[model samples]
Target chain A: MGGKFSIERVNEYLWEIPAEGDMRVPARIYADRNSIDFLLEESRNKEWNALAQIRNVARLKGIQMAALAMADIHPGYGFPIGGVGAFDLEEGIVTLAGVGFDINCGVRSMVVSIPKGDIEKRKEELARELFESIPAGLGSTGSLRLNFDEIDRVLTEGALFSLKRGYGTAEDLEYIEEGGRIAGANPSNVSLHAKKRQLKQVGTLGSGNHYLEVQYVDEVFYEEAARVFGLSEGSVVISIHTGSRALGHQIGTDYQKVLRKASQRYDIPVYERELVGAPIKSQEGKDYISAVRAGINCGFANRQVIAGLVRKVFARVFSTGENDIRTVYEVGHNNLKVEKHTIDGVEKELLVHRKGATRAFGPGRREVPEKYRDVGHPVLVGGTMGTFSYILTGTAKGMKDTFGSAVHGAGRVKSRKQARKGLSGEKVIEELARKGITVMAHSNKGVSEEAPDAYKDVEQVVNIMEGAGINRRVVRLRPVICIKG
Target chain B: MNRNGHETLEHTADMGVRGWGENIETAFKEAALAMIGLMAELDRLRIKRRIKLECSEPELEDLLVEFLNRLLSQIDLEELVCVDINVITIERLGGNYCLKATAGCIKREEVKERLLVEVKAATYYGARVVLLESGIWEAVCVVDI
Candidate 1:
């Protein structure tokens, strides 16, 4: 019942949804006709109206240049999934919706020194052993039992705290964004309820889309970059995708109420109430930011514990130390950062919010770790259980055009209900088993919803990023053992 | 007890009401019934308290999510159980839409067993209301324990 959206081909791979009515900045989408067609189909069904939400986000206070949507954009709370937007630090607003409910929900990829043959030799044992050792399912608690004091340390230190606890190595911090910790985290700002939830679930894999997969380097696209990331063809790897579970959800709910009143106080006329936000400098905004940063640390710490479990599983199965499966890179896709970027040819501090998108700083970006500053940030794009995942490098073009951000994964194409209607969870398990991929999940629905058929082709999504010069492909990974909750 | 029915629907089994009807309104009504099933007699309750609430979400499914979450919050703050779904609407506003819902609660003496957990709210997880060609509605919602 709305006006038809007109399309303008900016390039072979880019399309623009021009700013017309109340839109302060234009909405730019990076996708070909096939991608856009899939997007339109999702939008037409009113399932993923993220394209419209992207336009609404463009109208946020202090927004910079333009609001961008990745090829994998889907409907989310405030900003659409796979959406990217930045705001000027002095005049900008940090809305919790832009970063999403699951704060710091990102991907962590580990490079193993061993080969796939070694893993295949003990495949079934390794699968069962990993499933039993690692905790999964809803409200699952990890091995670590943190007291209040240690909880405070985790909230403040992020992965570093886990590292000190002997869960991860110092080198693991090298490839992590902000070294597995978002700075300026004040544990005091976190709510008591959030702290209580975080106490028991440090290393747990919470339900709904969270997973731990043992993969092999199936192929290499950029040999030099792959080698730099310690990747060799057929080498084993591990990937963990989750976030600050209940802690982040609690923080999002808490701030939503806080910002609801802050919006009226600050006179922020939001296009949508879900985009409830206040100036970054406001008392409410500052408090929420602190809590969100702590949530990011918890996520980093969560992944660290998962890594430790992986190490233990390997130790029991292969007798090799977990340190051998070194951390390749870790990044939080759903997060907001105060990064300095050149906007309109002037250096400006901007609050960059990436939802369902990864920060892909190209070569020479100061944020890139010292060792690989010469190459670029390792962008981990994970796919569904039965599909292929990729490791890509940030490009200079990505930094200049899209604030150094790239798509996170192959976005979901169907709803969980639709997936269930089309396929049975039991059948999906059998299919994976026949394919030689050992699948172990806490719940059948979890496995079915994350069926490889429910998502867009990761190869296609990665191709879009590479073709757009946003990221360069490094290595491709195929799942060997998958654990889901 | 083949609890496959609970898994078939998107919600957990803590609250009463095994399944919900299709469509947002029916699903919401069924959820209200589900919540009330945890408290006193639904049939004997009168439309005494008419509290209005609204929630917004980016997607229709998320709208169901916010709707349940807000309901849970109200139940916790007011200690009231919704007996009826008077005027429930899920319309798309600019980017997100509002779920304008009205409900009533019965006095304590009129009810049987009290609900176990103060259902803080229903979330987006496993929330579904799909309509079939035969006009049958199927709905599910995972309530917060």
Candidate 2:
């Protein structure tokens, strides 16, 4: 037993909490021995813990295989960050905490024609130009000022609204998840307040953990997957991490009340406040899903706009053709989607909730793009701007073990207040510059708040997932320039 | 100790906010400040204008969340920098708890450096409103940053 929890080692890189105390299925965690020990220690000492949350998710109605936590597991409200819970279509429920407030907070990585050396030679100038070009940080507004009707189109149309409006090109949409938009988005399902929030926020890269980074491939672990993802040693890449901005958060706030009431009305057990869910068949559930889809679309649109901005900055800085900059892959970490997964030799449509976990469809899965199907689509796992990030591909074993989901980031090891203590933005900038990184930010405090030391070693977390045979690494990226919002 | 006070608690990812006062209304007001404090430097805010906010919810716990969320929307969507807050009323309207307050504020760009991290939204996770044995009213919850 690890602390008060009875955990059995399934393998070197896996642990399980047996089905007990009203749990419908066992809970599994992808972690090494050290990570497991830390999780159990947190579970024993903290009111909110990843192990307990995975157990609570397992207890939710209609949970299919098992409640799984990625190696980056950390305490989050209701559901743990890096948690994945898949539920049956008919008997299961959809939850807010499962999706989180930043409705599709995700990553979009792109490859530019210019080599890594070009970026290194002009890193500081490029950093300033990109930071000035992109609207970010607290209270920043985007270039688009949409009317009510236009905002509706963005909700329903996703990134296409901006593409038609000239934010980004059609080819940019080709590599994005769901072609950058889902079909279930209904404008009527979303409230006017949420719409108003989006009118000015459609293109903004919001503050708090969101970043626009420039990097180069520092190492390649799986050469085949790296080639499929368009990565090679010393190749320049740009990755943007943000989401639906204010609109997504407001939709979550608006739906939390509706879903909570629906949970009580439908007699679904509310194991935790944020775990409150409504039956899939209920009107409230349908509305929340539609709204979430719209929010997801907004995230796609925001990233699309920011990606376009990156292209413009490159075109100006390096004097390169804008079309030469191509999208490698874009995927959401916080999302809820309906997918058909096989369980016990039968395929069933399940609502998969990935909060701080990304969809990592295995090779040959139809969900993966045709060009990348042989190797699986790239899963962009972010790292603190000062650390090493990774690009990985899903494995066939992961498809059955954890619904083909993987970690989104290093995960925080310290609180924001704790992180900010004894840290200054100027000091952080100088520290990074000494390491050959250029840093620019909208808020100096935001830089200190996101200090690299505050996070677990991302390489270690990614190694655990790889060690478990769930994912295979594609390439390692080292930051050359980081723009914080 | 001050009769009304607020402090942001350390949470691994998001932040936990707690506010205590002699009464429930004061507690709710302080809770709003607790969240706002995370977003800006309150003392240095220009405080050039005023914002009126009202929210009604079915329970006290929800009322607190609604109040903080409404403020977050204003801060994010409307760019309001709240310097100070006062709770005017926390009355029961039939079966719902209705809250009305006005905040002394300035435009976000007025003194931009006063802004800190943006608060995404207030959540129900670990949320509670209770009267303690020490005769203090407290409201506590977590905010997604």
Candidate 3:
């Protein structure tokens, strides 16, 4: 750990580090005075620096305008958590660093017909049932045992495969972005080892910050959007936040090795080796994009399975039927999607890489699901367990500003060591119970590491997104129960 | 100041040992001793079991993660408690790398407690090993518990 890297204010909400050394473009960050100051203080003299991460991102080959960091930014291996970068399809490079280890690590929120009061009555049983129904923790295996062929279909088809398997419905596919599958995934691009890892782990929630949360719509800020989402202020909801598990990790790892070698061979200079990459249309880049999309399919299918499990748990606890529970939307966070975004008044197909960030397309964007076209894409901002989570919708202003991306969660403010030092897993659990939030975990330390206090205020992060007009707060749901793995 | 921080132990000219946090270090050190104990006593030839440990992550988080995972797996396979460690190096180039260590093994007769499950590998998902401002070397490695 060293000292703080300073920032220069570019505008009211945008800060920057000038194009330096190998940086092809300036590094920009979206933060107010408060968050910016906090980041500057927290990153003082450590190997981790969002500034450095931003700079490295700006250096990615064929980046347009600037490399952007979202409000909830935090230092990560190559790109910061809430970092975003865009590269031209003709010449821009796609780096795995921008997508992260958990490919398609995303949020899937569903609305159920159950009343809030009734949910409160059965919350205790619901929490326990959910914890058991959903396999979690390290090396936890799901009930599904898939052969390579089945895994390939699941990877290629995403949620559609689950719908075909009778786990989900065709209607669910209509509600999902990209119909729950990203095109260009070649199962052959995925390694046998990766497939082996995915065999028994499809529906399992690998530990550390991954969770299945049950929430209720606390209030609605946008009535029409709420109506469109099939959610009412008091409607009970379920949110599953997870990713491609072992399969995605392997894809990212294998591609990173290839990218690192590719960068060297191409004579591309990066601030760090982890930031190595090549153009999205290049042979190397196309292979990774294909593999990553397949991984995205894995995640979508995984969430669908988990959603089925959620319905099962709810039915077992409340004695209800599957019709009572339904998925609202499944959104990807850590991914690179090639989309047309106007840069300098010209529309170009750019590889938009969002790491620890979520897509928040504004109203009228053809990419948004039909139900949400009038308002914008629904953005799910998860809070720490035992805190209030939020459902926000994208805004038109966001399209003009941040390429329609928003913060994923209250960014982690404390390191795991610092979190563990101040809080004990047992004590954190007791505190949550005292706050009327039921919690369950396979590991004690897991609970402590994810204590609400370990992160920045969710309200503040959401407020920033809302205030910036990138996303509008639709509803806030306080978690009455949470299950951690 | 405590075992939870970095505590160094002398082993031989080439290898030594170190404990990680207070709890894991105590466990890992015990694991180190167990490995050494196995090495010391295995010359007599009793039983043999081939053990495999696997942990995943990018290169940066590998050094501390793999080191801890290797020890944890040895503990499960050998059914012994390791109490000490003499660490040689925790370095990262393209990825993570570990050089040397020394440890002690718990005698079977002295075993009074066992862990929740076998630790197959330590992953890099949330692993962080660094020396802090307070002179504490902290790591947040996850084992395949």
lDDT of 3 by residue, A1-485 (tens): 42334469976677888877767888888788898887676567555566667877887788888888888887776788898888888888888778866889888888888788988887888887898889876556789989999999998899988777767667777767788988888999988877877888888876678888878877788888888888887888888988888788767756766786688777777565467787676788889899999999999999888888888887777777877887788888898898888766887778899999998888899988887899887888888878888888877677766778888888887765466677798899999899887888876676776788988888888877776667888888877778887
> What is the TM-score, restricted to chain A, for candidate 3?
0.97
Total clashing residue pairs per candidate?
4, 0, 28
Indicate whether candidate 2 or candidate 3 has the larger TM-score. Answer: 2
What's the TM-score of every candidate structure? 0.81, 0.98, 0.82
Rank candidates by TM-score, best first: 2, 3, 1
Considering the two chains of model 3, state its CAPRI-style docking category: incorrect
> After superposition, which runs of candidate 1 have C-alpha atoms over 4 Å from their true positions?
A1-3, A41-48, B1-29, B32-145
Model 2: per-residue lDDT, tens digit, A1-485?
A: 12365899999999999998889999999889988888888888888677888899999988889999999999899899999999998999888889999999999999887878888888889999999999998878989999999988998888898898887778878789999988999889989998988788888898999999999999999998888777899888899999999889999999999999998999988888989989887899999999999999999999999988888889899987868888999999999999989888898899999999999998988878889999889999999978988999999998988888999999988888898895787899899999999998888888888999888899889999999999889999999999998
Q: List the candidate numbers ranked by DockQ, top first.
A: 2, 3, 1
**Against the native chain B, what TM-score does each candidate's chain B reach?**
0.70, 0.95, 0.48
Model 2 error, position A267 (Å): 0.6
Off by over 4 Å in 3: A1-6, A10-12, B1-49, B52-145
Best by DockQ: 2
Question: Relative to the true structure, how large is the alpha-carbon lDDT of every model?
Answer: 0.74, 0.89, 0.72
Across B1-145, the per-residue lDDT of candidate 3 in tens digits comes to 5545332222100112333543323333333343233222333323323333333334434445455645643443344545445553333335534335544456433442221112223334334555556655455432221
Who wins the lDDT comparison?
2
* Order of the predicted models by lDDT, top scorer first: 2, 1, 3
For all the models shown, what interface RMSD does each have?
Answer: 9.3, 1.0, 10.8
Q: Classify candidate 2 by CAPRI docking class.
A: high
